[model samples]
Target: MKPITRYLGVFVCTALSACASGAPLSSGKPFDLTPPKTMMADGIFYSQRAWPGTVPMQVAIVEIDLQTRGLSFAVSSGRASDASEYRSQTTSTFLRESGAIVAINGGYFSPVVSAEGLGQDAVGFAKSNGRVVSPASTPQTAGAAKAVVCFDRRQVQILAALACPDRFANGLAAGPLLVQDGAIKVDPKNATRHPRSILGINASGNRLWLVTIDGRQKGYSEGASFAESALILQALGAAHAINLDGGGSTALVYRDPVQGPRVLNRPIQGGVPGTERPVATHIGVFTKAKPKT
Candidate 1:
């Protein structure tokens, strides 16, 4: 029988106890092996795999062509609880409503005590097209107000959380920075295991990596830690990467040729399989289009 894919949106209470015991699969080298299946269109790359890992990991990579595809942050429904109070939406809903070809859940939010089934409060530092979508949600807490990913007109950058200014043209703050200049930075000693969401940029900065590791579901996928997730992104060729809001907030959306747009991985939700947690922000990918002149 196929592995079960449903998961309740809850944080994995305990660490793997062994996630830090072994080296990353593939020796932390770029995975040169061709994907079992591949699809490329509109400059977007897609691959499917049950990645080789200590856990039964499921993954779908959406590599958007930054040079061709339009990448931008979309506030959930582009609406807040009170239109600036608390914004939120489903990944699928964000995709369909924003007309995004694909989308990955954005950075962290408030009232989010842990990674799963946590309450979705206000947003962290999130900027779109040079506008602050939400102000700093917290008062410079540790790992707070940091913009792990920054994209300017020239190139993308992986900066420290505090490095991000109050606002920028485009950027989001979420992470333990994974790779910088092609080197993995996550501490190998990290042993926690939970679902993961990563956003990365390749050597050329043209290809963006949107990676999701399904976890919290037994027999299907166990999940990945900061170090393990770093290894995964590095192997996939991310010159610079950031761990996004992971755990139950980990979600990926893609339009299936046959099934149309849908969340690909089984997100942990209320201890249920295939349930989704509403999120505060989403970085969306749309078909190639000329910038409005």
Candidate 2:
């Protein structure tokens, strides 16, 4: 119970780019998702479009509770935007006002654009748009990131880990709330699942489950990660898990509890910057502080 290093100065000086141990077995590259045209206000849910400029930039995911308290794990870049707004600032201004460059500590690390940011505290992988991507910039023999064992918020809620794809680079899949009776269907070439995914999702009470992890490697953080998709969401019963953003920075923008907030994921192209910024340190927003009648 002693591993607390909370440095939320945001992007400390951006430089990183050192990861890579192994994993990569795909000879059919080509994934698709256009995502654009969005709206959801009054507490907001985001998506004005732009996301890394198109072609599924790098990754994205957002699942805020209602406003802010404990369940708001977001992830962006790959032309980022997971809209469910409740702003203040920090998390590197949602990854540099929507162009991507947070580069370490949020979910699947990578975004070190630094004209003078990130400063120090190094990890690895930066330089988006021109391309560099991560999971530690792979190619060692393939297969490294893999530790899926969730439900550890002190050990029964969900803590999640799945990062060793050579020590971590991208293939995130944060947790809590996925209720289709929970879910578990592993085996993405299993070697433990290399940072592959499946996170816990309880959202402080029982939000169900609907998490995913299958980045499919393209340049970096190569193959078999997501740790059997976070042990298949802790064998389908997530308590509380972590790890957001995945290759092309995995995207998941769902807000349809009956149009309760109104914007439901499908971002890509259009002035961008609704909000997004990978390579994080700490950002878990949840809101519901208005009850006392």
Candidate 3:
């Protein structure tokens, strides 16, 4: 559990300044989704914006340089299975417990609401630290979990669920692939909006982006559709991206050395604002602390 201050930086924008002009920040075409403020560290950058639109939205983005030495990724693991039960925890809990610098909610799971998200099971394939935590769901059983992302110490691969490999150091399934081979894969007709969590990679595959869009809170942040989410990632330079488990489980947590673990988004669960829903799986990022200045 190293102190995050050695590897984390903080920056923020006032709501007044971000929305004063009532104009979206430049982010190419289709839509304007870049956050006004950006926080940067040695190998990581974080940004969040209060986007104004017919449906106002709030978004948080974290980009990490995979080529940075000592960087690693992890997926939450559960107890051995006799049945198919898995343990669950909030994203913030996962960040703190796993000693990861950043963490976000992972794939979809059953029993949307539970006492503590115990006895839950991932809706699709899940592997943690080389262990097959759960197998891929069959076509009839797979709903939103249509794609998978697998990663090792130095590489990451995104593939359709059916093509997922038998082994990977860490991986999870959760998507209707948003972008593939630098093209938008999300159908424009699928316009349903809700809070969202997405994972993406740059064309070179040396950068990884994690995003969370807050929604369902009228007059604040209403959320974005799959198409919008994909466009957002495109604007951020992601060539490939996938939607993760969202809705009440949409959350991104960062460990701030000074402030401790903090939830970067206003998550609404069970109709309660700021409430965090315990979820079945989470993806975490680790990095070596920067040398003292």
CA-only RMSD, every prediction? 8.4, 19.7, 5.2
lDDT of 2 by residue, 21-102 (tens): 2121232222212233122212322122111211222222222223323222222223223221112223434433542211
> TM-score for every candidate vs. truth?
0.77, 0.25, 0.85
lDDT of candidate 2 at residue 192, scale 0 to 100: 31
lDDT of 1 by residue, 4-29 (tens): 22111111122223222222473443
Candidate 2, lDDT over the whole model? 0.28
Tell me, by lDDT, which candidate is best: 3
Count backbone overlaps in model 3. 0
Lowest-scoring 10 consecutive residues by lDDT in candidate 3? 19-28
List ranges where model 2 is wrong by over 4 Å: 1-92, 95-180, 192-199, 202-205, 208-224, 239-244, 247-284, 288-293
Worst 10 residues of 2 by lDDT: 1-10
**Model 3 pairs in collision:** none
Task: Report the number of the highest-TM-score candidate.
Answer: 3
**Residue 58, candidate 2: how far off, in angstroms?**
23
Q: Where does the lowest 10-residue lDDT sum fall in candidate 1?
A: 6-15
